[model samples]
Target: MANPSHDRDPGLVLGFERTVGDEVQAVARSAGLVVDVVLWMLRRGGWSVGIGCGAVDEPMPASPREAAGPAFVLAREAVEAAKSRQRMVPLAVRGSDEGAALDAEAVLMLVAATGARRSAAGWEAVDAVEEAGGTRQEDVAARLGISQQAVSQRLRTALYDETRAATRAATHLLTTAHP
Candidate 1:
């Protein structure tokens, strides 16, 4: 059965589930930025994900008062839309009223591009850089014992810059909300 439960994005309070997929896709997109943060930390490397902003319902107990809300409904609809269109990621945006909204279609395209284009070596390089806290590509190359140029090429081929930029924006949205 589906583990129907309302979960908050870890390290960032939001109504959403984290790591919505298993074993990390080459690219993925989540409707919530906080979910991206979790994905970034958990990804097997070279994987990229986008974040969507919106409201979502947490799974509630037997109490109807705590049931899921419109946000959850909207997110569900977004996922269904993506599936119908064979998009790479699920998207749901609550617009400015909720948070940093993203165009689901755009995110789907970017994510699909990453998944379709990433290579195994590229994934390893990207993962290493991220695990090291976005370290310099030169440093990553040295660690991987490859030419800096090679690392640069891998990152470029994987669309690492664009993917990281999106993830960073999503993270900023989550952090800025608290302080």
Candidate 2:
């Protein structure tokens, strides 16, 4: 949804349901999609995101306009929390008896660091490294027809290593999470 106050800024709202004792591997898989979407949105300069996971009291309406439920409430709360913290994304997950809220601070920092249009080339350089299946920097440089030193500079400029580490941590938490 586009922010009402600022037409240029957009917000994303996501919700899902989970059962007790349900493994979060699927959630982890979905996080990859989230990561991609966040990256794409951030590149375009609007990355306000909110995610909610819980059971809804009301049935889903044919149109989203009529949708109202606990999940929606949680999502709104998450968005508010993000706004309060000046963070890009916030996630709230509710299980049968447990709930968790996370600020996604690390990923937001990574996004903020690379949000400028000037960083697009560095993002492409990072993508090249990732697409090569974590190949050596020299290999990435060769493939991109750039000097290794140039590739290194781009990687550093993009905070590639720190971003990768943060992503890994997110995946780990999601995969091992109880809720």
Candidate 3:
């Protein structure tokens, strides 16, 4: 059974609902008829196909198990999107416990934008660190026989490049929105 409380409400964001619905429809099409029935139930129960908000008093579920199938799929898509650098707004309830939930929401948005896979360099770095059984920058550098300074420089460069890319994207968005 779908949980009504877990439904997404995108509030005043026009087109967001349709965008979400399209994503659901894609998933439904992929999963065939069984999942389509689940999606239909979720939509009828107030879950937005895109962005969803939590009620001030009623919070979204913390675990995936607590969410309806469509809501879970939407959350997963949002997370992938965010990881891919797509812009998305996360829905959160108002409370202390809601902070983690909000973070989860943001993660979903990122995933929906990006994907499960990290960049090649990012994966390489992570793999190297894991193989060395050391997570610290200096330790990883030592295991790789490189100076910590070099590792730091590489990391900084990567960060700067990503920052530049993000800045350009933001600028483009602003220009398009105003123009």
Candidate 4:
């Protein structure tokens, strides 16, 4: 489901709901939505995510599972690839443009790997900034009960800006390869 929603990019997830057991099905029409979904799954952990970008039949279906097209077929294949053994990154992207798909996957994996190495305190600082919606560092420091310098240090060490840039790149790549 579209759980753990965020306001940092509300438009990325304006109206999404998922109701499934042991799994969830979703469709993202834009690059931002795709990246938002990927971030959500990564944060929750324990998900083998597949992002399929391509053409779907006209007239959207009631449910994602009921939808059909190259996108669906690519997504199935991507999921299988994600679940493969020795997969360092638990996500995959398959699209009409093979080059873009590979680029998107590489960039997303970098973001994921960087996130995985963040410490609890680092996440605390990062989340404070993200939740505040372009808030000042001092504000984040006050919220986290840490010194402003500490907040800066944490964000720096976390490579928050770098990761954010990487995420944006991934979104663009996905959009090109899929849409």
Candidate 5:
């Protein structure tokens, strides 16, 4: 909505609100969903995912339309910045703490780019293992009708461990960015 003040939603969807600049704005109660949203958006492809973290107006309302703060402003900036990037991963982070925000963005972009390079076969192995729980490479291999060695090879090629580690680091950075 170009004028968010005039528009109101009956209910929030996925902890975000449809707002101006084509933003699904996440506010206080919905804040915890940011990392999950980013991870899911990256896997789905074709989205410029931006995260903003910082102080919100005291006693924030349930609706994003009713909320106004630096966090919302930063989110707009982050998404606009993400959209402007040409050949890079469509992801960004912005926060009251600039350094932590940059660190978060760096880690997230590295992990996203690395995952982007993963092959379809590699994703299959990754999916299977994830579905079966991280402990069972054999289960993943059997489900995918590939050898355990092949499953391991695919994960190695995909750098799954590195991605997970980077994701954790990014999440941590995001948390530190605001509070």
Candidate 6:
């Protein structure tokens, strides 16, 4: 099988390896999964995987001013790839200090938000809000006289709930369509 890393950009390749290395180490220590072999399997399975900076990298900067150029580049790439439907995982290597951990969390949250938006449920809520003339979360909240946080929370919840419902509906439609 072709290596998923073969055609990927050099920076992305490094990021992937870095992320996978960290996850593998953690999984081995805590979950009993071998880091190397799992990565090998994933690579063979055609997944475009990239690793986030693990905790083992340089200390997290006190502010964005302190972050390394490469670190920011990798984070931006990972976030963009995730937004575009490419699978990106941030790997936090073992021994990463607390600061790095915080940075990793922020990156992962960006990935999750992207994933949520890509979901069918997410699109439905987005569509609904747009149809209702709400151009953005803040706009929606303003119209409803609620906090932006509340609007965000409601959008997320509605997306999840609607996605589940849509999935069921699709399944039923498929079943009946074929029957």
TM-score per model over all chains: 0.56, 0.57, 0.27, 0.88, 0.84, 0.23
Error of 4 at 68 (Å): 0.3
The candidate maximizing TM-score is 4
Model 2: per-residue Cα lDDT over 52-148, one tens digit each: 4444445544433445665556556644554466444332332222322343434444544544533777877887887788799999999999999
Residue 109, model 4: Cα distance from true site in angstroms: 0.7
How many residue pairs of model 5 clash at the backbone? Answer: 0
lDDT accuracy of residue 122 in candidate 6: 43
Off by over 4 Å in 1: 1-9, 12-32, 35-66, 88-105, 168-179
Best by lDDT: 4
Off by over 4 Å in 4: 1-21
Q: Runs in model 3 with CA error above 4 Å? A: 1-104, 107-119, 130-136, 159-179
Cα RMSDs of all predictions?
7.9, 9.5, 15.1, 3.3, 6.1, 17.5
Model 1 lDDT tens row, 16-121: 3343553221111233434453343324333333332333345533332244555444444544454455333433333333433444335434554564567889
lDDT of 2: 0.50
Give Cα-based local distance difference scores for all models: 0.49, 0.50, 0.36, 0.79, 0.74, 0.38
- Candidate 1, poorest ten consecutive residues by summed lDDT: 22-31
Question: For model 3, what is the C-alpha lDDT against the true structure?
Answer: 0.36
* Better lDDT candidate (2, 5): 5
Where is model 2 more than 4 Å wrong at Cα?
Answer: 1-29, 56-69, 80-100, 103-107, 114-118, 173-178
**Tens digit of per-residue lDDT, candidate 5, span 1-179:** 01122123222222466766656665533333455557667767778877878777868677777777888788878988899988568887899999999999998888878778889998888777766766688877778888999999999999988887887788788888898
Model 6: per-residue Cα lDDT over 1-179, one tens digit each: 12324223332222222333232111111111122232344423433322233222356433333345443444445444534563343222211233443343334334333434454544444454655663776776666676778767756764544543443443333222212
Alpha carbon lDDT at 56, candidate 4: 81
